[model samples]
Target: MSEDSPPGLDLARLRTHLDAERPGLVTGELRARVIEGGRSNLTYVVEDGTHRWVVRRPPLGHVLPTAHDMRREHTVISALGPTPVPVPATLLLCTDESVLGAPFYVMDHVEGTPYRQRDQLVPLGADRTRRIAESMVDTLAELHAVDHRAVGLAEFGRPDGFLERQLRRWGKQLDASRSRDLPGVDRLRERLAARLPPSPPPTVVHGDYRLDNLLVAGDDTITAVLDWEMSTVGDPLTDIALLIAYTEGEALGDDLSSVASAPGFPPVADLVARYTATSGRDTSAMGWYLGFAFFKLAVILEGIYYRFNQGKTVGEGFDRIGASVAPLVARGNAVLEED
Candidate 1:
């Protein structure tokens, strides 16, 4: 791909269509580049030499019908505009596949750093780091507090049987991509099924909530909570469990995406407590949720491994992803041992 053109985008055609659809949308020559490090959707930073914006589209080639719903992402961002979630301001959503070869949308590009490494946070010291971590929980509580019905998202997801559907979704994903025998996977899956906890009232769950997914400004405040591809109305505890599990893993020297192990970050209990106080949700049954989080992550990584095996994966780092599955399965089983 040339420097002038980003892969998966036809800038000339797109700009022409942009001007027709929304006049004056493109002030100058449009240029785009795929933002690296995103594992799922292809995110592009688009510019017109004056204003910058973000464009999101599904990855090229085969895709599941419901997986990369551009409309879903845009809808959620638009709904959360009046909420305290700090999502980027959405501009336009295009379902016309003729424009970008696939459905895509544009949003105002916010400035901030997604601190993915421990070294990046070390200079900030403990207090600032702790504040940032605390803010994450507060933001999550704020997000869960938003009523879907009030926000006109009552049909966003069927809250009934959410956990059961989630289990089946990941199970089928793992089976579809079972390239090897990960010993503890079946056992963990079975235990999760047999010991499923009754879910609390459904709230909008950010299916993949984590620190790196958020854009933090210099003041350590979250400028925008990016990435809502896995979002749905479901058990809010699932969101809490995932965050705790991620921080717990990082505390154990596991990098579960981001430098969550950095000094000054609050403990898992503290985060849960803050959420409980802020959102007034019961988290006593979190052990089961945390175990399920591990199982879900294992299944996800195994799928990536399967893609790598078929040589369908692009770029580096994929070689090391599949290896994390086994350990995650083991972690899943270990978490359940608390019961």
Candidate 2:
């Protein structure tokens, strides 16, 4: 490992593995740099001068159970490749921990932009931004429309009682990362539990679906959807609600992605309606889903905050993450009250 290589990735070992598994794939020396913006899994862009690919792995330390599963991420991306959903073609799945000190996978490096902030979209004009946002919704619909059984993912995830399991899972996640008192957080979780909405027919759910999670081309088309660590076979509405929650980024904090605030971006109602019209899924119960989305996000942020305080996080902007948890809890309570 070179002195300058990122913390988790060892370029020398990576080159050796690629040469053995997919010989001649790396024609020259491998070089890599951590790709910022992700707070959970570590993403890096690796190149051999002539060929480029993306690598994904678990965070440095303090990994929570069932989170950042490289195999799960690799499986979903590979399964969705044949569908209309745009996922980068997977090249390899390396589970050997000795290779990178953690499980990691490599996929073709895609060319596109992940619009993370309002300023990034302002230059694109409203028309293009609207088109990109709508395309994101439509692509999600396409993903939900895919038959998991047909995609060889019949055993991917447990869809039955998915909502219940999700609430419980996040609750446990909050418990695991409990560092300080987060007022109203437990109440928010209890309220969500008390009013769990019956999920519709299950589909592949993108656990974290938002504008920034997608890669948009110059023509405003979503080239690929990235980050599938939390994806599974579950209520598709969770995906919608999470996307809407991300749009409410003001309540979360400035450090979080808030591309929805950009000029020309479609309103949340329009995006919901577009999904309804595109996927034919009833969203009448979206109020509950939205509240649950806020709660889930709060727990996620709290976990990140715990990790940040413990010095387990990598990259900038994590310092501002802890401040968002309380606001998110407040937002969730407000949404449920309105509902």
Candidate 3:
């Protein structure tokens, strides 16, 4: 691997670029602070005098192919601007690598706390928790309802091999990022390969639709649906399955009497029922997608395990990530084998 072009951002260069691009929008000393949690992209909240903006660029050291494309991320969010879906208004996109070390873009900085710490979620009580959960589901539905062609996303992800690419792509990612040997991953891969889910009409799929990925406003409405780096044209049900996997008996922990068990959540069955009723899409192959969703997440977390072992990641809980794989694989297989 080639040496990375240094890890820190060059503020002097960034100030010069912003001056040429927007002139008076940002003036004075540019303060750069690093934000955590992103593995593929380097994000920073750039504050200049009275103005604040967000910048997203490719990660340092090494990056995966087709990952962290700032232009693609800018395009999708900009396209979604006119839609009812909530997203940060993208201001400017710069493909000129000379401006910064790598391609980066600027957008309006949204002010809201993200719910990443499981213990910090505050439960929001039972009723509000269910409302927030439903809003998350509904927001995803709205995204899928948008016409890809009309929204200028017709050339997005390939529609033909949506499911196949997902299965193969994530499977390959696991192989690349694996730090330790886990036999269940192989077994799950074989089962998925043997009985691939039937193809469905492709719709917009948020590659990582989950609770933490969204921002909640009052009345349980989703003000901003973020992290569109993985958004693509694919089976809409795939998004549903991803959302369910993030919630189903997981967020609330082993005990069912937690905040996620409120009346509003509607369980997995109810969530799917509501989604099918709202979209009028076929819901027959939900089981396959649900299992596939877990498989994909397991692969991703395992990658985090790899990074953690190498001392490249922050936070705790890397060791226990491997434990979640077996259960997820079994759940996926059970869904496939069920009558």
Give the candidate number with the greatest lDDT: 2
TM-score of each: 0.94, 0.98, 0.86
Lowest-sum lDDT 10-residue window in model 1: 249-258
Q: Which 10-residue span in candidate 2 carries the lowest summed lDDT? A: 250-259
| Tens-digit lDDT track of model 2 for 1-339 | 666578899888888899899987888878889998898999999987898999999998888899999999999999999998899999999999999899999999999999989989999899998889889899999999999999988999999999999999999999999999999988998998999888898898889998888999898878899999999999999999999999888547876677878898888899999999999999998888988998888888888888899998889999988888888889889989988
Order the numbered candidates by TM-score, best leading: 2, 1, 3
By lDDT, is 1 or 2 better?
Answer: 2
Order of quality (lDDT) = 2, 1, 3
lDDT of each residue in 1-339, candidate 1, tens digit only: 234777677888778767887799789988888787666678889899999999898866545436778999999989998887899999899999988788998899999987667778889999999988888899999899899889989999999999998988888878877878899898898899998788888888888787878899998889998889889999999888887776765533343555666889787788989999989988898889999999888876676667667765544577777767777888889999985
Cα-lDDT of candidate 1: 0.82
Please list the Cα RMSD from the true structure of every candidate, rounded to 1 decimal place: 2.0, 0.9, 4.0
lDDT for each candidate structure = 0.82, 0.90, 0.72
Q: Pairing residues by index, what is the TM-score of model 1?
A: 0.94
lDDT per residue, candidate 3, 35-104, as tens digits?
6655446678788778888888875534555666788889899989999888899988888887776898
